[model samples]
Target: MIKKALKTAFPYSIPILTGFLFLGISYGIYMRALGFSAAYPIFMSMLIFAGSMEFVTASMLLGGFNPIGAALLTLMVNARHIFYGITMVSKYKNVGKKKWYLIFGMCDESFSINCSVEVPEGVDKGWFYFWVTLLNQSYWVLGATCGALLGSLVTFDSKGLEFVMTALFVVIFLDNWLKEKNYFSSLLGLGISLVCLVVFGAEKFLVPAMCMIFIVLSLARPHPEKEVA
Candidate 1:
């Protein structure tokens, strides 16, 4: 069962493998450039596992030691995961102990694939979810370790490497947009986020945007009676 799950999950994670390697390596290199040892990136990749937050954390570490600031920033940056978690509650409910790891490892890529991809006949859903999450994190950890180890040996321009993550997000959004039959949710989210961005400005928009999106989505969800009719 585990073998079948791993085999089934690997292909789905290929895109994430490529993206995480480049981005993760870039993160490691960034940490190295910031004078952090390899252990920093390796452990951060293993534990934090949040690409964006990990990058932010490096900056925070260099700036000063403020646990309050770090905690708040982490919540703001990852507030969207709240929605991801809510959406996943039903799917992850009956997965047994694997549910805990599934929640912990529910990075954007893992959530995206697991949320959307259907399990094939005879494959264990729980194991498939577990393998996907494990594989994705493994790729990230390997990439971070590699880049950190190589950081001293190789020197080149990494000026624009940060944009790789943004590019990956764009690709993921487009892929989902194309696959979705209902554009209302997508349009609403994009519109609300844009409005919030303009109103709150780049530095302070995310949390407000997420809050509004949640409120609006909850109201927009059709009632059971409406769906039945």
Candidate 2:
């Protein structure tokens, strides 16, 4: 069952494998450029596991400690997972003890593949989901570790590598845009984020953007008729 699950999950994870490896490596190099040791990347990649948040955390660490602000910032950055969890409640119901790890490791790519793919006949759904999540994270951790180790040995220009996160998000946005028919949610999010960024500036825009997003989404709940049709 596990072998079959791995085989099936591996194919679905290929795209993530490529993307995560590159982004993860870039993150590690970014941290190394900031004078952090490899331990930082390994632990953060394994534990925090939120790619964009991890990048933001690096900057926060440099800005001095503020547990309250950090906690709120982390929550705001990862607020999307609340919606992901709601959508996944039924799909994750019978997964047994694996549910804990699945929820822990349910980053964007893992959630996307696991939520969308139908497990093949005779392959256990729990195991398939577990493998997908596990493999995606493994790629990230491995890539980060490798980049950290390589960072000291090579010292070329890596100034613009920070944009890796932006490039990754753009790819994800395009993927979702191509797959879904409804643009309301996407457009609203983009518009609101842009406006907030302009008004609040980069340092303070996230909290307000999240607040606005939540308020708007709550008030704009789709009708049952449209959902069913």
Candidate 3:
């Protein structure tokens, strides 16, 4: 079952594999440049699993150690997962115990493929989702470990590489926008987030933006259905 799932799921994950490995490596190198050990990235990639938040946490670790502040920041950065969970709850209902890991490993890319793709007749949907999650994480961990270890030996400057994550997200948003004709939700999210960021400042904008998104989306939910009909 594992082998079959792996074979079936791998092709779907290649783009993520490429992107995650590059971003993961860049993340590790950033930490190393900050005087952290390779184990830091490895453990973080394995445990935290949120790419953007992990990068933000690295900077946070260097500054201060306020547990309350950290907790709030984590929630703000990962608030979108609330929406992802709502969308995925029904899809994940019958996956048995694997649902826990599926939820744990539910990064954006993994969620995209699992939620949208239909499994082949012979493939186990649960195992296919599991492999997608597992393989994506493995790429991240591997890349992070390698980059951290290689950082010390490399000679080039890697200053400003954190933009890679931002660029990656832009690419993802654009991809989804291009794939679907109805982009009201995407446009709404982008417009609201940008306006909030401008008004509230980057550090303080995420929570407000998320709140606004939830409220607006909730109100507009029925409109989209009506438009489709």
Candidate 4:
């Protein structure tokens, strides 16, 4: 099982590793710029393990976002996972105790790649997915730690580095949208997020956007007439 999971997880190390290296450096840069030491992200990544959230964490910590506000923002930004997790219910049938870790670690990128791939009938899909999650996280930790170490020395404008993370999401969103037969649902997400962001700002917008997304997705099912045609 270990061997199989390692093999399956190897291919994923490339993308995951790339993200960790770049995003880790970005986080380190942001943290240092905010008057924090390099060890901050290293510790945070181990505990938090959420990339985008970690970026927000640096600012939140410095500005005193508070636990309640931080928790709310975390829930809002990551609310899409509730839907992502539903798809895994049946897929992880034989996983048992491992299900807990799986659910806990499931990220947007990990879920997308795992669900899209077909793990042969005899292979342990659970194990394969598990390693992918593990490796992805390892990359993040490595990137953050390494970046923080480097950030202490390298002195350049980190102002634009933060945008790299946002750019990554844009790329992922576009790639996913391109694969969808009808991206109308995705468009709805974009529109809803924008509106909520404008009205509620970052801290308060996540929950509203997430609720709106769920409502839209639930009601936006294809019409019976369209389905028949």
Candidates' TM-scores?
Answer: 0.88, 0.77, 0.80, 0.74
* lDDT (10s digit) by residue, model 2, range 1-229: 8899999999888777777877788889999889888899889999999999999999999998799999998888888788789879999999999999999999988887787777889999999999999999999998898788885675556566555455656766778788888898889889999999999998778778878988999889888688865
| TM-score for candidate 4 | 0.74
Give the winner by TM-score.
Answer: 1
Give the TM-score ranking, best first. 1, 3, 2, 4
Candidate 2 residue 160 Cα shift, in angstroms, is: 11
- Sort every candidate by lDDT, greatest first: 1, 2, 3, 4
Error of 3 at 164 (Å): 9.1
Q: Write the per-residue lDDT of candidate 3 for residues 11-111, one digit (tens) a residue.
A: 98887777787788888999988988888998999999998899989999999789999998898889878878998888887878988999999997788
**Which 10 successive residues of model 4 have the least lDDT summed?**
157-166
Candidate 1: tens digits of C-alpha lDDT, residues 1-229? 8999999999988878877887888888889999999999999999999888899899999887899998999989998899899899998878899999999999988888888888899999999999999999999999899889996686666576556556756766788899999988888888998999999998888899888888888888899787965
- Candidate 4, residue 209: lDDT: 88
Best by lDDT: 1
Which ranges in model 4 have alpha carbons more than 4 Å from their true place? 154-206, 220-229
What lDDT, from 0 to 1, does candidate 2 have? 0.86
lDDT of 4: 0.76
